[model samples]
Target: MNAITQINPGIRQQILDAFNFRHATKIFDPDRKISDEDFNVILEAARLSPTSFGHEPFRILMIQSPEKRELFREFSWGANGMMNGSSGQLGTASHFGIILAATDELMRAGSDYLQDHYARVKQLPDEVIEIFNGAYGKFQAEDHKITSGREITDWSGKQAYIVLANMMTAGALMGIDSCPIEGFDMARTTQVLAEDFGIDTAKWKPAVMFAFGHRAKDPEFLKTRRTMQDTVSWF
Candidate 1:
């Protein structure tokens, strides 16, 4: 690889521009489709995102079948309709995704899943794995006090959001629109996944969902935020 020397002048502005261009697009142009190439890039961005301990204890389910999307209408209040009566993200977006975080059984300090992950995926030696697991056990038991199954799952779920953010930003940089959704009944959605999608709820639970496509129209309001001085602090 060639060594890099100087930074591009407008690189920072370009990144900020992508953030400004992105919005919670509620409606998408059904007629427009995201190319397989571009969508794969978004998925790759998600694949490369960092997770706590490199565990990557999350999986993404892409919902593309019309039948599946139609089924979501019954549970996903956030994606069922637009305020203006147009079809919402589920009905019109070119792609939809459900991010599933691994359950507590797979994430506990010395669980079988973590053991295999350390030895195989992370390529760590047996001695190193033992040391790492000891530190992780303490982190869970004392530092974070993650005792209950619910607490463990919630911790894993937070890592899924990191991947979700990367995928959305990648799409925005490519001029694709996206919306992050959390407006579904968790119990109902979980039941639906188990019954219709053949997902094992015992091992994985849905953390969040998203929709992606070309926006049907521009948002009416400009993006707003607090001033940088008000939002950040220098130590």
Candidate 2:
């Protein structure tokens, strides 16, 4: 059945409950692992997330091997910051997802990469396709004028956050806890990915990371949130 047809009152409530149950989990149960089936579902949610202009700018690296996790843990501890030092979550969590954003070269208009991406949507008249490409080029040019390609990373990184949120919510729906990690040193992370995984840093940059597992126990802090009226406004 389609999503619209399935959204009855019960299903709607379940959706809200999923959001309510999710939190930035600080402590994870080291022994508990998310089943492969459920983990795939979470990944699927990220795969299907929306991106601006259909650029699909994010790449996800799932780090689950014990040795690799140890490498990341040591890196996080060595990074100079309160947040990095407190990253026990990375060491103990069952899995880590590193989100990387595509570099300017891949997303540049008229590049073979983007042309191939746009061509796959559907066959368009040549004139229409030209118009689309021109518009995209103009947009990128304007973005570059303002930030000199730095905005490419910023824009692509924003898309990765969309995937991150979707994966976290999908995991929550499956009774998995998640922590959105933004405390690591980006330069060090880029170095690690290049040295260990052979990922080319010039082509893709690490945008963010996340930890997933079951929560060790109830959090000491209660759920404190602003009411809908306080945060939302009507037209």
Candidate 3:
């Protein structure tokens, strides 16, 4: 039998508390900023997140420049409601991030990207690489039934969300507030990313965006959730 490590029971309560403490914070205290050490820990959490086939088909772009935030603010309708005067999460948050997911060309099996990834990054032997390619190809074509290019990109986006959630939860555990934003014009955002940020939109597309900071005001409403019986079923 494998060795089983002991875990503290109280650690579960602490995790629950952190989850309860977290919410989609709107406006943030502009004066307060997250220290580099703390933010690095959060980034590390994202880096350590798991991805399908260990192919980390995502990238994170940290938007710390005020000019870039302003450019995003012009197209981000989700953050507009939270704007205090001229600033919202984009303007006030201590840190902001955009998650980009790899496109079909990079995600499809037997692609040059996966070939290099399996060889160099994953360090798999040639035989193993051949096996994985077959398995992964079946997963993409048959198991998942990916029909269009968009579906492949969407699959990669699902992996990116894992990183996004870990980053936000890590911040929450550290007493930092965060809000995930998806309300933006995709075309406009893509244009800005290509023309302004100089990202290769063909290879990677924006999946999601989020902001982290200290909340300017505590939420007035209480957190609500469905009962376990209603939300989950046991065999």
Best candidate (score: lDDT): 1
Flag the better candidate by TM-score, 1 or 2. Answer: 1
Q: Each prediction's TM-score against the native? A: 0.95, 0.87, 0.95
lDDT, candidate 3, equals 0.90
Instruction: Give a tens-digit lDDT track for model 3, residues 63-181.
Output: 99998888987789877554446477887899987899999889988899999999999999999999999999999889999746899899999999999899889998999999998
User: Candidate 2: worst 10 consecutive residues by lDDT?
Assistant: 77-86
Ranking by TM-score: 1, 3, 2
> For candidate 3, which ten residues in a row score worst on lDDT?
78-87
> Candidate 3 at residue 83, lDDT?
45
In angstroms, the error of model 1 at 2 is: 22
| Selected candidate, larger lDDT, 1 vs 2 | 1
Q: 5-63, model 2: which lDDT tens digit per residue?
A: 55578888888888878888776778898888999999999999999877898899988
How many clashes (backbone N, Cα, C below 3 Å) per candidate?
Answer: 0, 0, 0
In candidate 1, what are the lDDT values of residues 83-201, reduced to their tens digit? 55766888899999899999998999999999999999999999999998999999999998997899999999999999999999999999999999999989999999999999999
Lowest summed lDDT over 10 consecutive residues: which window, candidate 1? 81-90
Q: Which stretches of candidate 1 lie over 4 Å from their true place?
A: 1-6, 82-84
Q: For candidate 3, give the lDDT of residue 169.
A: 90
| Candidate 3 regions with alpha-carbon error over 4 angstroms | 1-6, 82-86
